[model samples]
Target: MAEIVPDVGFLKNGKLKTALLQHKALSKSGLSERLFGLMFSGLVYPQIWEDPDVDMAGMELREGHSIVTIGSGGCNMLAYLSCQPASIDVVDLNPHHIALNRLKLAAFSALPNHSDVVRLLASENTRTNTKAYDNFIAPKLDAATRAYWDKRTLSGRRRISVFDRNIYRTGLLGRFIAAGHLLARLHGVDLTEMANARSLREQRQFFESHIAPLFDKPLIRWLTSRKSSLFGLGIPPQQYDELASLAAEGSIAPVLRQRLEKLACHFPLRDNYFAWQAFVRRYARPHEGQLPTYLKPEHYRQIRNNVSRVKVHHATFTELLSEKAAGTVDRYVLLDAQDWMNDRQLNDLWAEITRTAAPGARVIFRTAAEKSIIEDRLSPAIRGQWTYLAGRSQELNLQDRSAIYGGFHIYTRTA
Candidate 1:
């Protein structure tokens, strides 16, 4: 496959606008959508929120399987490399994500060893990571990806400098987490205390004593009520409505509180990297906490050896599927992108998914609501070809350590 150079002009090209602008310009929803597109056109997720363990289990990924997934933050895509898939095609509309994915592949191939890879990707250090990039990774990158990292920010720091300071703290999601910490500090709460909890009981106690009460604050409730406040979470207006609808009183704060409680109390801090990122703004060291599968030392050699199997594309899932032969792909991971789609987009996406999926192929996606968003929205003709794994989806949803999504859905092509 030839390299598809990323078109950095996302707004000018109108791809993002077409996906997000569901209401008329000048309307309240339209302005919110436009604002979200602008914010999302750049990097959003510094680390993807969906649980890859749940994804691999739901898909039942096997050696030599052909997989296609959205490349958010590139963690899960690298994690999937451990499965030794024949091919992993990653699709994303964001140019920065395309750059990031390509950079990870290059780092795996070019860096000296596992610890160097970990230091560059997972740790926050004063060590000159840029030297590692210059001496090793940069030369291995394709011209487009190399340029992306070399590009200077307003501060004049090279984009790759994020690795030195803490790449996890650099994206929109990172800024959002920082802002949450600031808000909590103003209320005399240090959210990082959740990370100090040594047991589930202590976790729950911290939440009940310090975190849970914030949801009832007049200011917190008011801020969450507005749609613009959640763009950092990558929740567009459409998804925000779905999330807000889940709250019995139509307030997003309670919904947020519920999710936070699960994130803090449902999983042990020592085994959940998602919790570490949420509370501490960086991953825990190897002995202190678990790391993402790709970052784990045991899997490092396997992922590095298989990095060539992964490919990143700057395109939509439906668009990419349209170009593939029927019955070619065995697994699909959509993340939460479906929550942002309209009915027509949903139907078009499923139409191609059904066409391109191999028999017994699996599709996994996350949603902002507990119910499957496509349950009634997809046209029956397109929807009937696949069976929804409701029980299995619910089972896996409970196991997802990320604790952010309201639903995790699985569909298997049967005909």
Candidate 2:
């Protein structure tokens, strides 16, 4: 009764209007259904991409402001906890994501120390992770989440046992990253060398020398052209079309190349854990002074203390907001989910957001294209309630350490 998947149907608790079925059809296609089934079926994200540091910069959260965000890998939830929000509700359509978030919270509560937690999550030493999970985390989970990680795989080991191998390289995104590494190796590139760069200049030099040429390879060009091939980036058919439209010369390859270049070179390897996970397939070592905020040692005690302020739900963002009292939520992070909605769905979502937003409430989201249709999709009467911060959005977008998205937008409810 908790999980939700909007158009591909697996809804529970809330129901869409019968009249909106056409909008569902317009938004989700046959290919998108099959892939979305696959994407939502298993673990979709091993980490969240919309940078928390950039998001925090734009949100400028007040003391005790309630925050709502979409939980992907649950990394940013922990990051947000560091800011000492009054409460945080993280919703997702995937039940597996719900379980993962619970597991992370459980780990923070039950683990003996921060290193155990880092090793468990950073995918560094896999041998003891399952034991750690069983010993520290299992007794703390709810029945459904417990049944999820406890379910036996075909190999006769617990499903959670995958972490004991390489959880980062296991999910859809992980498999996609593995494929990219395979392709890079064939072209005589070593993605792991990205971990060694000491400066932005060295990062750029390494990328130009080692990684950038792979994009021009005919094999790579052919692979990137196949939309099915990008399921790892978690792009649905609708979002793929958005990228196609935004791409130069009507090709997604160039857009992806530019984004990958940004991921590889825009930030120092020592601080950009997103780049480390992309190229090295693991987080930077603790000694390296590079990590997501939640993973760093200095923040551990605070995250541990504030972890209880977070609650995870397997539901759509609108469903969660619709049920909340008016003027209750102040900070919202959409995490690019709006890209999947059609015009009607977009309007429906915004209607609920506008209704629930407190005065001066801020909303942040990413888009596959640099420009979004919010101006057209939403009537001026409805849209007038919020002011979009174009300058702030662009400024923060440039500083996004992850750099996978095309646009990052911030909007505030003015009245």
lDDT (10s digit) by residue, model 1, range 122-188: 8897467999999999999889889889989899998999888998887889999999999999999
TM-scores for the candidates: 0.97, 0.92
- Poorly placed runs, candidate 2 (over 4 Å): 1-28
lDDT of 2 by residue, 1-415 (tens): 3543322333331232221123344454654545455555568787887788888888996568899999999999888887889999998876667788888999998999998888888865569899999898999988778888888978899888887877887778888899989988988888898777888999999988888777778888887777677878788766777888876663477888889899988877888888888999987776764878888888799889888899898777888898999989999999898877777778888888998898889999999888854768887778989999999999999999888888999999986
Backbone clash pairs for candidate 1 read none
Give lDDT per model, in order.
0.89, 0.81
Looking at candidate 1, what is the lDDT of residue 358? 89
What is residue 237's positional error in candidate 1, in angstroms?
Answer: 0.4
The true-structure Cα RMSD of candidate 2 reads: 3.2
